[model samples]
Target: MSGHSKWHNIQKTKGAADAKRSAAFTKIAKEIIVAVKQGGSGDPANNSRLATVIAKAKAANMPNDNIKRTIDKALGAGNTDNYESVTYEGYGPCGVAVIVEALTDNRQRTAPEIRHYFDKFGKGMGAQGCVSWSFDRKGVIVISNEDEELDEDTVMMDALDSGAEDFSADGPVFEITTDPDAFNDVVAALEKKGYTFESAELEMVPQNYVTMTGEDDVKNMEKLLDMLDDNEDVQNVWHNWQQD
Candidate 1:
């Protein structure tokens, strides 16, 4: 129901700049591997989960060749990656709720590294369900309208008709939210009408937001996020920190 925060903005700007393209694509490829194995198909047409992940890859501007290669590799013989989905719930400075979602082959190595990050901020990590209670898992789709060429009313109507739960416009960006189960269906519905996306993926939407007023608190929070982002195993990080 609002603009995605500073962490999101940082990722967008960096993604657009290709500053972390290789690393980002590597993480996404892991998602592809899991999606293919779990969904039991390499073809996105028949696999809703794979379709959603492919939409995410497209939004990230991952190359078509890379995507195809990853899918092929996933379906190939002797592919031996077994990634377990793990979620870490924690608090940052000023009681900011943070959740880190990861896919790791080895829990032992990934667990200690994640714990180290939280411990850096005074044992910030907590039990799995601790902070997730305050968030809703939602499918969010974003569209860029920087030139104001996309009409708000038309877009809103289209999104609503396509089964979006909510629509919000901030400056030149439009966000459409949907139920996680209906995410791929909504995306496909919109795409059929020639709508392109800036980002389309499931996310942990925080129910409330809090600001970090102290300088040290903000610095620690930023560092914590950076450390997580640097890890190849970590996929998504969600937080309630209100950032500009």
Candidate 2:
């Protein structure tokens, strides 16, 4: 887990979605709609993609009513607009590889906006597979270390037995990565063992990390990331930025 991952955990601890956290809720809603449409099933029990989105929504403390509404919209759709899942690969300041995953009704609108963000920061968007080649998609589960009294070995055993691919310890938290196809089963097993985690979702992890040393470049990179985060169409952003 990295600081960005830790930040998400901390946000949950702070109850960041207390009716006033519109931004997070909006993102989760979009994901739910897209997942439902793509999965071809509004039922979370049968659809792993929908289940993952629901898991993320639950982790964010999003209201149950809101989640249900989004699912309904996806299922009872008389609309013609279909949200196309797209991944745009680019680099940020200091040559930090960036990947933006979006669900859009129009690629015509999203392409140039994503490109503009890179250009504004003096970076150019790369071809579709350029930066994505450096990353692998995996299911990430984050667990807390408060009063649970679990060590790296214990966590590893639990995750590995449930078909988890890897585990990493970052400070007080443990990161669990599983095969994308086996994510739901692994989560269910961990839950059966009374392992309550902070969040579980599919994520893009870089094969190698890039460290930014200078303060100025770090600030610029932060700015670029913030800009991407502010975009409603952008569902998730992954990067190789490792602070030194």
Task: Give candidate 1 regions above 4 Å deviation.
Answer: 1-18
lDDT of each: 0.85, 0.79
Q: Pairs clashing in candidate 2?
A: none
lDDT of 1 at 236: 88
Q: Estimate TM-scores for all models.
A: 0.93, 0.86
| lDDT measured at residue 90 in model 2 versus the true structure, 0 to 100 | 88
lDDT of 1: 0.85
Q: Tell me, by lDDT, which candidate is best.
A: 1
lDDT of 1 at 70: 95
Error of 2 at 55 (Å): 1.8
